[model samples]
Target: MTAITVSRAAQIRFSPGQWLTAGLIVAFLGLFLIVPTGTVIYTAFVERGTGTLTLVNFADFFRSELFVRSFWNSVYVSAMSVVWGTVFALPLAVLTTRFDFRGAMVVQTLGFIPLIMPPFVGAVAMQLLFGRNGTVNLLLNDMFGFRIPFMDGLNGVIFVQSLHYFPFILINLSASLRNIDQSMEEAAQNLGSSGFRLMRRIVLPLAMPGYLAGASLVFVKVFDDLATPLLLNVKDMLAPQAYLRITSIGIADPMGYVISVILIVVSITAMWLSAVAMRNKDYSTVQRGGGGMARRKLTTGQSIVAYGIVGLILLLVLSPHIGLFLLSIATVWSFSPLPDGFTFAHYGRVLEDSSVYIKNTLIYASLAGLIDVIIGSAIAYLVLRTKLVGRQWLDWAATAALAVPGVVLGIGYLRTFYGVTLPDGTPLATLWFMVVLALAIRRLPYALRSCYAALQQISPSLEEAAENLGATKVRTVRRIVLPLMIGGILAGFVTSFATAAVELSATLMLIQSNADAPIAYGLYVFMQSAAGRGPGAALGIIAVILVALCTFASHYVLERSRRLVEQSHGTRH
Candidate 1:
């Protein structure tokens, strides 16, 4: 008999498996994307009295000048903030990555401190530091006999947001800068190119992709942010306008939906344009193995100036959080460099009544984190590994959540689930399912990005070898692929947990009264009361500690896994 060897393709039929995967994907999309979006559209149209469709809501939104002003204001604020953020962050990234300097590690860590604070908390800290009666103003009045206009209008909002988000640009650009090959710069320098000229020609172009990505993210984040504007009293912003329409006015108002739709369109368009910019450029500057560290000793004056610049940036980024932390421990923080009185009363209050917020935040964050990692890993695998049709679109769709603001998504949920009834006639007004789904969807982009990046680093040959050895696709994926991806998945999980814990805008809208409230919401409420500030500060402190713990855990796990992988590689070598 002729030696008959069945092809691996014959062993694994692409037909059934592909169809099943596709079906599962379709079901997932329908449950998460289609149903929630459909709810928004359905509620926007359905008339209350007649139970018929109407366009009055949209019409009112268009006709309202206040709404129009808010839309324009949001655009202006986002544009201004992005410009300032880039200006501040790009140089910082260049200094940290290109020039050898003291305190670089401290500067980098300081830059990222703002990322841990809740949006409203940042705004509140800004208010405390710069408001008319704030510490700066009080000092100025004491010494200069006049008050400065610092915390009001569009300017304050832009300043706070830029301070908060510039790190995004810094981190992205620094990674890109570190990845640039020294050979190119060495060649340029040998060709009689001056330092400035070399940077302009050789470095900037390579870093443009990362710069653009950071800029795009900042724009989207600032554009959709509600807390800063609201706290700063910038009434003319898109997010607060949407909130006013949904909560202050009513969901029946079309103005909110209109603003939401506009915000979505703008954010999506920005993301698409950024993606295009990234696609056209070879961002492989940061790829593995080719580019190594290029550390150059700086002259005395240059080193001093670099250290000074880093210190200034660190101060700008960290002062607000420092102020907040102090305020959290104080009986009253007004006008003094030190608190009026130091007390642990705030911490005690938080500890005593912490059950509800703590439980809710942990439960929701844990659930969302777990679900996001599982679903996001599958999506990443499907998009990166398989040659499925529309995989590109699926990848895009999965990440599309990044463009949707928390406020807009919350409103979309409100609109979609307004009248959704349970099996009984009672209307399902409080849809925790939809809330959890929204959190998962909003966080999916990060999880997917982390997973996809990790997946890309892994060799596909391992999977192919397993299959050739008669391992089923599912078995191979479970035994081989997942083990390699544990680090990435854990990273995603921690990120999701951190974000879900601090998430404010969506939780504000979706959380039902008499139900559990997350720490962010509780902090907001506590901040408003006389005794509330103490508890609020306490909650904020707890949140910071929790986030720090999770981040450390993630780093530890990832590092251990990486060491194991490296040892295995060494043994094989």
Candidate 2:
């Protein structure tokens, strides 16, 4: 009897669905994470002649000044970006969320523009404006008889990255600030608390979670970025270091793997800290009753300052795409204030050769979007809705991808799947499936978070009611849960699609020699070739338009679907 009871208890603990979910999670980690990581480690350590593990890779990396300098350089750049991002983002968030001025809506929208633009595009744009022959440089030289040195190395990379990522901090902090109960601030103000003291004691502590979350994201992103550094010739960083080990040096060099491991460790630590910060606080300001938006009137001077700030931000964010658009349409690009002449030749050439790039990007992005929504929804359900063992670990693992740099993951994929062959004896060395998989995995964290946020808003009693009526778990999920969660799934899909479209570093390593490249990669190639900058600019312009169209379409579809659901529910009632 005792033995039977123990056996039953164990069986209950490891139920079928739980086991199945666990298996799937493990399989995903194995294929995408473990196998690739293990491969890198294995290749890094294995002795060529004796086929025995060694530690030469670590030794070599530690001894190399280039590697050490790049590692510290990466840390310095990322830290600086975070500091600047926070300094600018905090005030903007507080002002926009706490006190409203004229054109507040416009300010909020403009602040988020950088979120959609690719980091590489931002880097390129900065180069065009601040480079030796750039507009700013030309102006400075004409006025002061000297040019500014802002486009060569660390300074350029940090500036562009910070500009591109500050929006993340702004949006996050804004949301956090908006979530603070008005009564808390009201009570403080009533007690004669004013100015910085009120913010220091009440507002900052309340909004710390959002600030930390945003900072963590920026740190991980800047750390993992490869394009900004690469474009600016700052290859002493981990991203470029890892890339060089694979392409410039041979895969036989273990230094890349060592950097990969270190990146993973640092990213995981950042993520862990962010998770700890977010655990006790709720950052959801879009709830049912959040006071219907806090509205505070701004003074005349404040309104002018707010509008000026918005205009400046818009100019900064839009300048790159504007320059790219002009270059794309110009017949000749010289050191003039504008293009030499406008023509449709570049667009025509792009259209003629657009099929391959367009098809590849659509296919890969679509597949990644679908896969992310499904996997993300399931993980969200498992963690937020179900009572599962080791749920927190699963949640953390799902999001851990956010902290990983695309370049590092790309290297891991190369190492893990390099020599392995598929079932029909076809070598997997040139398969672009790994590239798609990497994109999917890399973008999974955001998708999962979006879905989790949506799922948490739903009442558990709804699912319980369905189950009480004898509905099977699967049926209830399909009929009851999915309908409610479709909005989240679609949102995740849009976000994932956008990220995959612009992803560069991971694609750089995983893309096959013969396979079609996405627009970002294609632009990189075109810009580097002998054909000057016309073609690359044209392609960038097209890519930007496509992204805008897709996002607008997604918004329309989601809004229409939501309205239809509401109408149908009203009819039923």
| Per-prediction TM-score | 0.91, 0.90
Model 1: per-residue lDDT, tens digit, 483-573? Answer: 9999999999999988888888888888885256888788777776556776687788889888888988999999999999999999999
Q: What is the per-residue lDDT of model 2 for residues 354-399, given as tens digits with 9 covering 90 to 100?
A: 5577678888888988888888888888877656677677778777
Model 2 misplacement above 4 A: 1-18, 41-56, 273-294, 422-425, 468-470, 530-532
Candidate 1: which pairs clash? 39-416, 57-254
TM-score of structure candidate 1 = 0.91
Error of 1 at 23 (Å): 2.7
Number of colliding residue pairs in each model: 2, 1
Clashes of 2: 1
